[model samples]
Target: MMKCKINLNPKMLNLLFLISYVLFVFSLFNRDVSDIDVFYSFTIFAKYISLVLLLIGILAGTYTRKEILWFIVLLCIDFILFIKSGVLVFIIISLFAFHSTKIEDDKIIKLAYFTLLIFTVITFLLLSLGIFNDALTNRWVGDSERHTLGFYHSNVLPLIYSYLVGYGLSSGIYKKNHYMFLIIINFAIYYLCGSRNVLVATLLLIGSKWLIDSFLQKSEFKKMINNILCVFAKIIIPFLSMISLIVPLLMNHIGFFQKLDFILSYRFTAIYKIIQTEGIHIIAQMTNEMYFDNKIVIDNGYAFLAIRYGIVMLIFLSAIIYCIANKYSDNTFVLILIIIVACINFIDNDIIDYSCLPYLIIGEKYVLESFKRRGNNYE
Candidate 1:
């Protein structure tokens, strides 16, 4: 009797990974289905399936020693993370990022576009049908009501819309003429959600793309402008990370910093409170107050990562961002998108929580190049 061997086709693996990815993304954003047993099981199933497929791909494929070392390092970091927080999501996402190295950028873009669209439509439908309630509340006394539109908070709806516009416009999926429609959507989101910061970020996405396109005729000026933006891109993550950490320490002492914190809705104060409560660590540890009862969510992404996920995780994220910035230094649109996201990260915790396209691109550009350099053909 001859032994049998099963060889998984790489293309099929890629297709399966993409499907599982979208399913996982859908599971993440569909708030109503979270309590439903079927969808809850589906989320777990999708995540583990994606993880298994990625593990198989990594083990079966040929890779350089350096690449293997990098994988090991990531595994160790994630293992520490898992031990500390009892969360496997970070490791699963790391595997997804690695698995994405072999896939095409276009595939990720199209799938992300549709996935986000479906999520948005479903959320709206749920809200309209009264299945999901709007988080209508006033943060300050005598303030107007802000609508969440079925999301966890008022800003979430507009933030998701901003990401949709960012992915669509930066990928060239949406044309310049679509800016009017997109801007109208932003205004409507602001009207309903009352998220001014996200509204500005959304408008900046549209305006930056338009400005870049108009100046394309002047190659020298365009190149100069892109160079400036690229430099900003390289430093934005570290700069924001520093500010997120340092601002809280300074806010009480400096009136300017205090006013800035007030403008940011006292995010610095929240950061200070969390720091005083749980404290920062090299590796993120389980907090006594895992679910804060203070009613104010940590809005700063950098602080959230550093405080919640650990300073090491934040550093790892910054390194990944630097890699992306270096890889796309010449791609002005993507760089601008990075800067926009980084700016928003200062106030919003959406960078790693929700967005998938950036990581996919990072894997495509940085991870794929590593394999290619070692004469490994993913195809």
Candidate 2:
């Protein structure tokens, strides 16, 4: 018997991955396109093609035992959830893309930032010309209304703008480049979107990074502070995890929490209602019932995941993120990016989008690299 063999060029595969990722990002804007049927079909086709290319890469690439084990575990959880096959495929593709790609992380970061910058510029130009005004809506803040540029809803623009800001800051900080212009552009867009949460989150993320970096520069205090932080992180992370799991249940009875929820646009209240009325099994199936008679919207990403993919899947994902963070503890850029995204997720369901897959893929690649280093050291 002859063994079947297939070979793929790493460069070609990487190029294909980049192209597919760009297409996927473009597809996100398809929501605003009027001819939904044709555009939606094209978007779906682009996604499937990306998945196919990623599948091929996975077949041709080598994976560590740790990677394979986690992949199988996630696949099992996905099978149980069973509603969003596209999401499952996305997870698998991300894992494989991380394993198979030959591009350097810095290059990938630059590409992503460049792409976002282009999109922001183009969108701004279009908005200036009065294009997409039909899709624009007003976002209420206190007693006034603000414009949301070129988005069907006010929530989406802020999420998108925050991502750009996060990536811009990450790249700028890492490269030690002057990114003030990029930050300004992102802030202007966020302001126009009328998302106070996004503005606050972006500033907090940037400020947090700056503070950490400044503190670490103090040679005498650096080591001691690092040790203290590590210990605190160990305790606080698990505590926070438990808090997240129970926050929905608590939102119903807690008066102070109810007021806070109302301030945050009733996001927690809506999620609590969904879980209470629909049961946890609602996560195992995809439905629009979370809209609460097509009136309420659950904007929290964690809540969306818990309701759309089940508690088990959500826990699994949280664990995966925890593992990645633990593995890449020294990479401040990755850590900051994750933290920013987590903050944004509290206000929007951006995690469910295809754009987030690249970050996960990059983190997974780091995990695989760590595994290889461990094996090498043991040998």
Candidate 3:
């Protein structure tokens, strides 16, 4: 078994985090830039930058010794995918992986790191070279807008999110001037693009996190259940608001940002629109490549893996589920993230996005981290 070890200065480790944020920042400003199929372009580049940071960041995580043969096999997948994403980023990350000292943790983190490393590479290449963008945007010959010189796309989503999340995290007050406007802008972008998956994922994440948090914070079973109900209410808040919309919704009732809240209220309608298009037939056709008469919706992460890879693979792939359940079961955010992944795993382009894979792989470590931070007083 190969040992997972990457030794670097603390400063360097912090720099990696800085770089990761930089990548995310780039994605944010680039999100709205004019380019055909800009959404897909931004997603790839943003993810690519995230992947590179992850590879370097692996050293800071809880990674243990390798499992001989499995490690080699996974490494091969990483190699192939890396070749696909970008040779340069792949080489840098792979080199970092090879040279860095392993931190202490479960096997899942190690595997997740490897899988993400490969996914990052392969995805980068596909987006950069594939003719899909040109075809989708009506630029079969040569679309300059389709390809940004440094990367792809001018405006990006991550940068926008960074500002929103970053401000909220650091300063309690949201930049009402910026994301106050962005709330509608992003909602519009999402509506036009028919990107209902992210919203559904967000709701799932919210519910799970809320439920878990309630389960933990309450002392009595009744309180726990109440908290869980509150979790449900937090999620239902938007849906309920939609109902309120028809009945004269009062501005003073739901806090602030009524317009953004109203946008969220329409989630069901947007989701229904998606349901009409994807149906079962489209799912079966796409899965035919992997199996016979597979009606599974491979667009979702869970479905994608189950159909092509089967139950056995999913068990191994999602091994961290038990870890998270047992330890950080009370973590509302983690719960939400898990739910988000699970719900959308079967709906969107889960196979390509490869977002949930990282969550699954790092689930245990994150669970433990969340649990550790919760303190002993957690009831």
* Top-lDDT candidate index: 1
Identify the superior model by lDDT, candidate 1 or candidate 2. Answer: 1
Superior candidate under TM-score, 1 versus 2 = 1
TM-score winner: 1
The alpha-carbon lDDT assigned to residue 306 of candidate 3 equals 32
The positional error of residue 194 in candidate 2, measured at the CA in angstroms, is 1.5
Cα lDDT tens digits for candidate 1, 65-90: 65656666677877888877777767
- Backbone clash pairs for candidate 2 read none
**Model 3 per-residue lDDT at 352:** 26
| TM value for model 1 | 0.88
Pitting candidate 2 against candidate 3, the one with the higher TM-score is 2
Taken over the whole model, the C-alpha lDDT of each candidate is 0.73, 0.59, 0.38
In candidate 3, residue 75 scores what lDDT? 54
Query: Which ten-residue region of model 2 has the weakest summed lDDT?
Result: 232-241
lDDT by residue for model 2 (16-89), tens: 66776666566665564333454567877766676666666665655556556655654465555444423444
Clashes of each: 0, 0, 30
Instruction: Identify the runs in model 3 with alpha carbons over 4 angstroms from their true place.
Output: 1-7, 14-186, 196-298, 307-312, 351-354, 357-361, 364-379
